[model samples]
Target: MTASTKPYLLRALYEWCLDNNQTPHIVVWVNEHTRVPAQYVRDNEIVLNIGQTASHNLSIDDEWVHFSARFSGVAHDIWIPVGHVISIFGRESGEGMGFEVEPYQPENTDTQADKPQAAADKPAEAAKPKKGLKLVK
Candidate 1:
């Protein structure tokens, strides 16, 4: 949980964004050997814009009770921040808790991520790197 003392690297990143007033958008990752439908994975890692939604009182663990990312679909209404996020689909044991957490890191193809004409996936095409999205507001 983002509110806990656990080492939530993703939440740390998002917190860094919030402190700077930048919206945090994340790309939830999967094991390199895994394959799943996009719809099933979209909300797994969200691209939250964190507009001015008032923090609510919905219950979760006491520490995770804070303003979080709210997105479409998914049953849960709000997110518990990156710190709260541990493992989403059990990347560790491959059979671990479906909602358990591990750690998170933003993909850092920053240089290529800035290019306009590059495809979203930025398919590996021989050394040229893929790009990353940096919110400017």
Candidate 2:
């Protein structure tokens, strides 16, 4: 993926998984990437540290997410628990085609993905936002 499209890739992935009824895994497809500061990462995954992701279009569930991110220290993937997610933001540019995996509600299995459902499917829309990976292909 291109540099301009790296950020939003995660959000697209999350949406993709939701559309396909699958789960999105957080991963860094690029060799060089920045890591979200440790202090930013939290226990309940308050934020989806943009640095946590390596490529665009990658994503993960909002429920206590945990990932093995590369950050920038080494050439390998390191463990980044849900607590590590310091921020949750959207992709700034790209084809707008990425995806992420979030907690599925049995009640909203029939409804649409983007449409906010009743209390059953999505209890509170303001509860917490999930993280996404910005990478495709």
Candidate 3:
């Protein structure tokens, strides 16, 4: 399979935001693989400020995005699978791109027994507007 372009686009937009003096933020779809503060998430998603001033040791690789930031005066490490990133936008201008949210599946799962029964038994549903990004005028 061809490699995904999402990570490259994300990195480029982040640099663009920084160069334009705008704060870059990312909208992430929260799932079992996502390691973010649960309290801040709403409707299974979270908007993260990823600007240089907000995050430390920030790294956006093909598979994951890692960073350390303070939340309510407590430092926490965040790990998000790149596939779960729904969108990237400037906090000020709200201009950027949005991508389809891919449900996470562990590669190591060898059998149906290793998968969650709820997920395995459930039928796929259409993506909901609330679960994905929307463009605002």
Which one is best on TM-score?
3
Candidate 1: C-alpha RMSD to true structure equals: 17.4
User: Candidate 3 residues 56-116, lDDT tens each?
Assistant: 9888877778888999999877877788999999999999999999776665444434544
Q: Tell me the spans in candidate 3 whose CA falls farther than 4 Å from its real position.
A: 109-137
* Candidate 2 deviant stretches above 4 angstroms: 1-13, 16-62, 75-87, 93-137
Summarize candidate 1's per-residue lDDT along 86-130 as a digit string, tens digits. 332222223212234544233453555643322223234311322
Highest-lDDT candidate: 3
Backbone Cα, N, C clashes tallied per candidate? 14, 41, 0
lDDT of 2 by residue, 39-62 (tens): 434442323333324433233433
Error of 3 at 124 (Å): 32
Error of 3 at 54 (Å): 0.4
Better of 1 and 3 by lDDT: 3
* 10 residues in a row with least lDDT, candidate 2: 27-36
Model 3, residue 135: C-alpha shift (Å): 41
Predicted structure 3, TM vs. truth:
0.78
Candidate RMSDs in order: 17.4, 15.7, 10.9
Ordered list by lDDT, greatest first:
3, 1, 2
